[model samples]
Target: MKDFPSCFGENGVQIADSSSSSSSSSSSISKAAQNLVTCVYQCKLRGRLSFIVLTWTKHLMGQGLSLQIQNSTSQSLCKVDIKPWLFSKKKGSKIFEIESSKMEIHWDLTNAKFGCGPEPEEGFFVAVVFDRELIFFVGDSPSEKIAAVSAAAAVFVARREHVFGKKLYSAKAQFSEKGETHNVSIECDTSGGLKEPSLVIRIDSKTAMQIKRLKWKFRGNDTIVVDGIPVQVMWDVHNWLFGNSAMSSAVFMFQTHKSSGSHSQSSVLNSSSSSSSSSSSYCQQQIKDSKLQGLDFSLILYAWRNE
Candidate 1:
């Protein structure tokens, strides 16, 4: 059997379309901790495009990482898992082969630092070398050494995140490769009873956007400015309003665009994208393509309710 790549694999949690099987989502969300996060980076190697998924896991055991590299066709190329129980080491390296190419991945976090989340905050380094060329390097490692090892072959392109909260969900996001990362949060309280529900999103403690009467507007899109850049924000809250206990979630996509006149318009509701058919490959393709080139960077969020 071939090992397929999934964000939920290493964590022992596999999430499905809440709109279809709300019970499963509810059970899985209840078992999930709050400090876990997954990041997917679109990269280029030898003129070919691919994605690198880095999942940071945090539990009673400790902090670890799960990495999956896949080609543009969504086929899994390689996967590296650093499980806490099996290795008990703070830092190490792994080697693997892809189509007969010798590839090496190295990391050093013996003296690494971390914040409240599973992701490292400082004192860490991760490098990827292929056939003696440094394809990618991230951390405090000397920049000159990286350039000397090999020419730059990989670039951080896009990312995705999974956030959980009962009323407020937060995450750090960089709208551009060179943009400053800001603290962003989404606040919503649907316990309106007989009144209208409200949705508020803030970046760096500054209000960037707000939606009133979210119950009536369960699915839609709009433009919001974060750090002075126009970002198209699309949302689907059907599950929040009417999902079974297991299906209580809201999906949001914040896409940063380059053109100024390209956004700030109301979007037609697209139910087919996040409908019960969300498990379909077509839906997954649409979700991934939401970024790419003209669309630039995107922050996809799946906010789960604890209630």
Candidate 2:
């Protein structure tokens, strides 16, 4: 697995590649591995403020979900993996120890409703309880809300989306918990031997921002508006402009507020969250150094250019 430092480029994060796939097969194994969505939450676990990372992935083999929690001190609170290959692993509760505190994790996805991605859109509930107080949840249904009210509050801080496209990339985002999902589209033409490429970002089919001189401004940031809310935008088109076969991906970021996080890191986690039998300091270090404090929502995009 490539560490964040080595895998990330200046323009965007590189997501996936498959050298084994035949060109005739449009959606190859490599393409399926890149379909991923991740959510990060800033919450308190056992009175220790922490960042919890939840990732949902889709591949030709199957679907998977995983969670990792790290505290302010960069201690690993817990990590869980759900693979439905076996019937016994579908829905269950887990108990673990963090700082001598019994952490309870409850998840029920057997009856969950899923969208195109591995993430369940509804009909599911996952909770983390520390010292018997609910700390985090992944649902907003009425029942989920009631349970959340009794638990310690957590904030949705950021999201990392892995998307595939040729020239035009599209995705959906909810700036806030109460905000409506908006259509986000990124259009850039770096091919056709144009002396200077251009980039355009649109929300709801309305152009929010554009960059005309791409060569000089391959890595830069701007701001846009969605549902009357202001969003900060950042782009890195280095790969689309100067990449060889080994490096052919760009990355973009859309955020509601300014945050201090590692731009060099890709949201797609290739490391095992359950590998360590002792500590999760490495994983926590990545999230801790991200400096996501006081930030609300961040959308990190890893844009891979298809050749």
Candidate 3:
């Protein structure tokens, strides 16, 4: 899969080059650890399937939001950026054209309430209308003006978030479109004077997966069952184990996969190698293939350690 940092693109955040000076590399990675959340939804635009990407960022001025619509081939159709300085322009609409179809985006965050994260907890509405038809809608209270289009209901496909904590990192995820939201907690003890560092993952306060001897198995994958659904958990923590802890962030992926008579959970875990290269390749292939069928849900987490 593409590294979580790449999803931010030019707006902000990027992976540092290996050849860069140590100080420069540290600055780059530190910038990427900022608070941000990106969500992907699959919906129909002009009767054709498309992907809508929404990114929420937190900065010194205030919160920022950006929207991008892309075709099946991942080509950008159009994009809009609502800067943090434009806080007074809370409620507005943007008009554009895509393939001769008039596309309109309306957002109202006048009373939007937010917690520690960039995403709003409630009191907001963002609607996407194509040719005057409501194709996508999000937020707790949608505007009373926009009518709904049944055929254009979007599917929640993927999410990427940056979480920070000392030892226990937590986030919320829904494995399927209709699935229940569950609390996800990742705990790893890597303090000094500790001989053996281990990793533990919990869902809704219940242990789902655990790893021992994390130093040796810094990168690996396993299968866990949550809400009777099989979720493939892959993690890469080489940086936290050996690299610069202050500037490095570990990655975790939780993906729900379909089970067939010929395929077994054991096979999936066994085929996975304890190396970053193999793990990355497997994840990219799975995501790329599943997007075509729209049958899987992916949750990616970038965990930053607190110094």
Q: Per-prediction TM-score, please?
A: 0.80, 0.74, 0.83
Stretches of candidate 1 exceeding 4 Å from the true structure: 1-25, 141-148, 151-153, 268-293
**Top candidate by TM-score:** 3
Clash pairs, model 1 backbone: 26-246
Candidate 1, residue 250: lDDT:
73
Instruction: Spell out the clash pairs found in candidate 2.
Output: 11-236, 11-251, 12-250, 12-251
Candidate 3 lDDT, 93-160, residue by residue in tens: 99999889898988988899989888888999888888877888898777667755442677776788
lDDT for each residue of candidate 2 in 40-136, tens digit (9 for 90 to 100): 7777554545777777776555667777776654455688988635444656788998778887877877677877867888877778887777888
lDDT, model 1: 0.64
Best-to-worst lDDT order: 3, 1, 2
Candidate 3 weakest lDDT stretch, 10 residues: 8-17
- Candidate 1 — worst ten consecutive residues by lDDT sum? 1-10
Could you say which candidate leads in lDDT?
Answer: 3
Candidate 2 global TM-score: 0.74
Candidate numbers sorted by TM-score from highest down: 3, 1, 2
lDDT of 1 by residue, 17-117 (tens): 21233344455553443445666666666667766666676666777877777777667777787775645666667888876887777777676787877
